[model samples]
Every structure is written in structure tokens, then in C-alpha cells.
Target: MGGKVLVFGGLRGSAEPRPVPLGDLVVLDPATLEVERVVSGGGGPALSHHGSVPLHDRWLLVVGGWDGRRRLSALHAYDLAGAGGWARLEEEEGGGSRAPHAGLSGHTCTKVSDREGGVRTQRRFASLDTLHVDAAARRYWRNPPNPGRSDEPKGNGRGLIERLSSLIASGSASPRTPRALRHHSMTLVGPFAVLDGGECFNKASDTVCNDLFIYDTRTAGGRWYQLSGTDSEMKRVGHRVLVVGENLCLIGGRGPDGTSCSPEIYTLEINT
Candidate 1:
């Protein structure tokens, strides 16, 4: 919420197959363009494509991803306002057999709250596919229980609902959300979330996409609509996107060639 940016697990390299998944947690000062801190205490090996959700003002919950060798469904919590360390999120109230499902990677999870002072999670993305050829899946989970802190959201590692489709069309004329989006980046802006570039398997789509799509969660039936009128169609993968006031800023990623790195950056002005 301040001038800081939090970065979690990701891969570091220009080529594919195995690009060195990273497990370090990093915080950066965007204004100075410098890294302020780095912590490496998460409960697992190095990972990439993990989803993280802010639990509240006090903590952040890091969820499933691929840990280099295998897809991981491990959960870890990081204390932002207190002693900085990682605590593994167990499956049961008193801890039980087998951890929470770890087969989720390349997914998107956002923090959502209700008027009754309860917070839950909303997630949508393709499951972990080394080839990026799986169908996009939507899922939701209720907060577990009270976590001692009045403001902390509890998660018991159960109650996951799968909504197979989120690509509902508003009308036959309305453009549907882009398909074959696995490695995309999404930024929450108010009631809408904007999804940017990502890659698909060469056999499935044979290309990376630079298209932009918007998901509206304000109404009864939420759907994804393709955003039009952008002159720059820059295909990319493994990119980062963030909201700066009313504008959306896109940073570095692999370019159209798939293997080449893109040094150029672009910004899209949002009228909303």
C-alpha cells in the first residue's frame, strides 16, 4: 500500500525446460528502483508461478506453485509487520496427514472481503501443466478459522470449490477472454482485474500473446472481455504488471521471439 513492491517465487533465465526457480522473497522500493530486503525462509524448495494473497494488514499468504522438480501445493505465511519468517500452513486444525493440495500453479488468487467482516479467496487459472496446455479452472475457498489475531483470516486447508468455467460471454457479439493463457500476469484494479501477456504450449497455440482482457466481478455473472484500441501488441511471457494511479505499467518479459528478452516497457492509460 505504500511505495513498496513485494515479489515472490519466480524463474530466472532466458531459456525453457529448466530455468532455475527461485524461492527468495523480495521487497523493492519502486521509487528508488532498488531492492530493500530479501528473505529466504519459505517452507519449501525454490519455486515459480506461485500465487500470493495479502491476508490482511499483518500478514501475507503464499500458496501453490511449481518447485522446480514438481508442482507444489504447500502454503506458507509471512509476517510483514512483525518478526520476518515463514510458517508452514498445515492441513488440519491440529496438523494432519498429507499437506494441502500442491498441484496448483500458474493460477491467480486475489483477496476478497465481505461486508460482514469476513475475508475469503477467489482464484482462476490453469492448473500446473509443464506444457501450459490445460484448461483454465476457477476455484474458491473459505477462510479456515480464527487465527488468534482478530484481523487474521483463518484457513483450514479444506473447502475448495472448483468452477470449471469463467469465460462466460456477455453476448454473442462481446469478445470472450483470451484462451491459452497460462503464464499471464493480472493486476486487480477496483472491481475489475486486468490480465496481460502469457504463453501457451506451442502445440496448443504455438505462440505467446500480448492481448489484454478484463474480468468484472461487480455483477451477478462475471465475464472476461477483451480490451480493444491498444496500438502496441507486444507478445510476452513471464512479465510483471502493476497499477500506478489510473495507469497500468508493464515491465520486462520474454519478447515475441519467445527466447529473446524484451528490454522495452509500455504503459496503458485506463479511463476507469
Candidate 2:
């Protein structure tokens, strides 16, 4: 319920209780509300009320949901190019199972260009890396952290002689392990991917955040800053967000009370 909702295939009726979550794929045209059945592979377990997003070209990436009884961490990609069928990607090795990952249902998953050319460039594909956004942890662990930073040296200026000795003898280096984060929302701002608005659950309920983060492939050092200037809303959970050009459109979602489908829309402008 706290994931993304993809408008593909076509809009169908409200999901009804059925055996093995309905495998039917319905996408809302946004123009017309007509329900159309996009080709779903053979008789696989019916998938309904799950998170889906457009991947590369004509491919949809689906992850996590209740399959009636148990929650799923299975990562399946549906290729919409030919006669679309489901292909399961290998699960993350040490990463524990993920469920109800935010920004999945009713949320938006965008394909961002890692390079300046576009998404189709080979350079972009070479930089194609998976970012695991742990909503509960409030951090992002890039599969391969920035190589340049990961191999940098660290430590305060100590004895100059000792520092020089250590640098030469041991090749002074500081490796930063990938981190896990929670409560953050990940979206694409033009060619850059932005991770914003989440709290680090360290301090006792006092560390809620409204900070904005930007990761650009061209830049060696990423950028992070608090969203100032305007009277912005508090960081919220269960809110659905979609990227339309340089603007991010946030829609109805659960507040402090509970889950809501009210017709409220908020737009955030980004320079991209």
C-alpha cells in the first residue's frame, strides 16, 4: 500500500479478492480510464496491488508485495517490447528481504541518465549501478560506492613524520563501506538522481529531516543541502511522488492518521 502505482496497460476496476493476487496487468492511459489487459506471461501467480515501474526501454521492473499470505522480495522485470513476459533477476546477496518499500506503490520509479548524452548512451550503461534505498534505514548504499572517494585517505593531521611514514608504508587509505538509509525518497532530477526528505532514526524522534541530496555522475563529490527559502511541508511517509519533466508531483497518501486516497496534489520545482 505504501509503494508506487504505475499507470500502464489500462485502468481496470478496483482490485477484487481473488486466488493468487490477480496476475492481470492494467495500466491507466491517463487520457482515458479504459482498462486494457497488457500481455502477462503464462499462468503465473496473479500479481495485483504490487509496485511496478518503467525500466530501460519497454521494460517494467516489479518488486515486493503481499502474495496473499507471505511478503515477496522477488525482483521480476517484465519486458514490454515483444510479447511481454516476466523474468526474475537474481536477489541481493546479503541484503535482507525488502517489503512495502516506499515510493513503490502509487510511487514513481524513473530511469535517469547517468551521463549527459541520454539513457541510451553506452557510457550511461557502463555507469549503470543499482542503488538500494532502504526506507527504514534512511540511507542509500550504492552497489559500488564512488571509486574515487572509497579509495581516499582519512585521519586528522597528526605528527607529520608519523603521517608521512604511515602513508608510505601502508599506503594511507580510508575505505567507506556502503551505508543503509531509511525514510528517504529517491527520484530523478533531470540527469541527476536526488535522494531527499527523510530522517535518520538515531536521536530520539528529534532527528526528522527535510534535507535534499543530489548525486550526479559528472561530479566527483555529491551535494547535500537543506530545502530552505519557502515554508515547506514536513517530511511525510506514504506519500506518492512522480516526476513530470523538471517538476515532481506528489499525490495523496497516508498521513499521521492512516492511509488516504484524497485528491490532493503538490508540485515541487527543480532546475534539473
Candidate 3:
């Protein structure tokens, strides 16, 4: 969140769709673009295509990504100001922790506020909770809904979404959790977390969307608005939406063709 440039393990010069994931944490000099320090084991659970956000100013919250084999629901935290390395957040299970909800990959986790709450419904239990990252204690708790649930074909209790969408970026037939985006981009603007251009998880969930979908962070319970009837001719993914004054600008990103990266920039007008 500060002026620090933090990087986790990611794919580099690989042709395979699901290449071996990396788990190293590195900090870079913001001015010189040079490596400052590298923590070998700070990057928890070899991950790629994950979502992350800064906590306070010395911690990073990484959630839900592909771990070389399958999608992971684990949320790992790293302490930048200390030397404790990585920590896995979970519930009490034989003195170990576990995932709290169905796993997600290529999804985005937006930071609304330090304190927020939401309601969740599971196969058995309906829980009311929120995300809690304790920077002072250097620990993360699964105050989120649906404790100890998994759907990655890892044989968890009553797993959901048995088949992976054909649109998954990995180009595999692996089973994944519901709403697992392939490689979308999401950004926070004003009061909404605007989601744009991502691979569709399944036919039942959503189709390949290039249009704008806004989620009101004011309430994490239930409120998703889609701006349909946009220019369907241009399909974008892995793109970014920037708020330029009263207008939102769409920046450069590879088109749906997966080859040509558009050089033009366009602004979007939302009727909100």
C-alpha cells in the first residue's frame, strides 16, 4: 500500500500453461527498479496467478491461486518488517489450519476498509463473518464465512464445481472452485470494485465478459451490477481500468485473440 514494490513468485519464460509455481518474495527499489532483498520461503505455497493486497504497511495478504497442481483456497500472509517468513491462516484442525472457503484463481480481492462484514451461505451452514488481518499480532484469522471448505477435487467435504471451465487460462481440464476466473483484472474506484474482462468459469456462472461489472463494496452481501450492451466487438482480458477524473480509462492489454496487444486507449462512461 505504501511506495514499496513487492513481488511474489510468478511464471517467467514458460510455454506450458500450468508451469511450476514459485514461492519467493522479493522487494524492489521503487526508483532504480533494482532488487533490494529476497526472502526464499516468504512466498507461501508455490503460487501463480493469485490476488494480493497490502496490510497496514508491513504485511501482504495473498489469497487463492493455482499451486502447480490445482487451485488453492489458502490465504497466506507475509511479514515484511520481521523475519518470521510465511504463515498459513486457517482454523483448528489437528493443530493445523485449512482453507475457509471454496478456492479461487485469477480472482481479485479488493481492500474496502480495515473493518467490513459479509454474509455467506454454504452447503450446510450459513455464517456471518468478515476478513480479519491482524497486523499487530502478525496473524491472519479466517473470520470469513464457510470454514474448512474446499472444491479443488482434493476430496474435501461435499466439494462443489466438479469441472473446470474450458476458458481457464491454464488450458487444463482440472476441477476448480466456482467463480474461478482465469486471468481477469479488477480495480477499486470510488465506492465500487470494477471488474473487467476475464475468462468465464462456466456456462452456468457467466460467459466470457469484456463488459464492465461493478460490485458495490458498501455491502459485500448481495449487489452486482453488469453494464450490458457495450461494444462487444472488442474483447479484452488482463487489462486495467483507471479512473481519470470523472471518466474511466481502459489501458493497454492483450485482446481476446491472445496475440495482439492493443495500443489504443479508450474511456468508458458509466450511467451510474
User: Model 3 off-target regions past 4 Å?
Assistant: 26-43, 82-84, 92-100, 115-129, 135-139, 143-182, 201-210, 216-255, 258-272
Superior by lDDT: candidate 1 or candidate 2: 1
Output the better candidate (1/3) by lDDT.
1
The deviation in Å at residue 28 for candidate 3 is 5.1
TM-score of each: 0.68, 0.47, 0.56
lDDT string, candidate 2, 106-165, tens digits = 222334332211111111112223444432222323343223211111222123224323
Instruction: Please give the TM-score that candidate 1 achieves against the real structure.
Output: 0.68
Report the lDDT of model 2 for residue 104: 25
Error of 1 at 161 (Å): 29
Q: lDDT tens digits, residues 64-125, model 3?
A: 78788887766777877746577776543332235446666655665545443111211112
Which consecutive 10 residues in model 2 have the weakest lDDT in total? 116-125
Residue-level lDDT for 236 in candidate 2 = 43
Worst lDDT window (10 residues) for model 1? 156-165
Clashing pairs in 1: 72-102, 73-102, 144-154, 144-155
Ranking 1 against 3 by TM-score, winner: 1
lDDT tens readout by residue for model 1, 73-130: 6666667765556666544333222335447666655544422222222234443211
Best candidate according to TM-score: 1
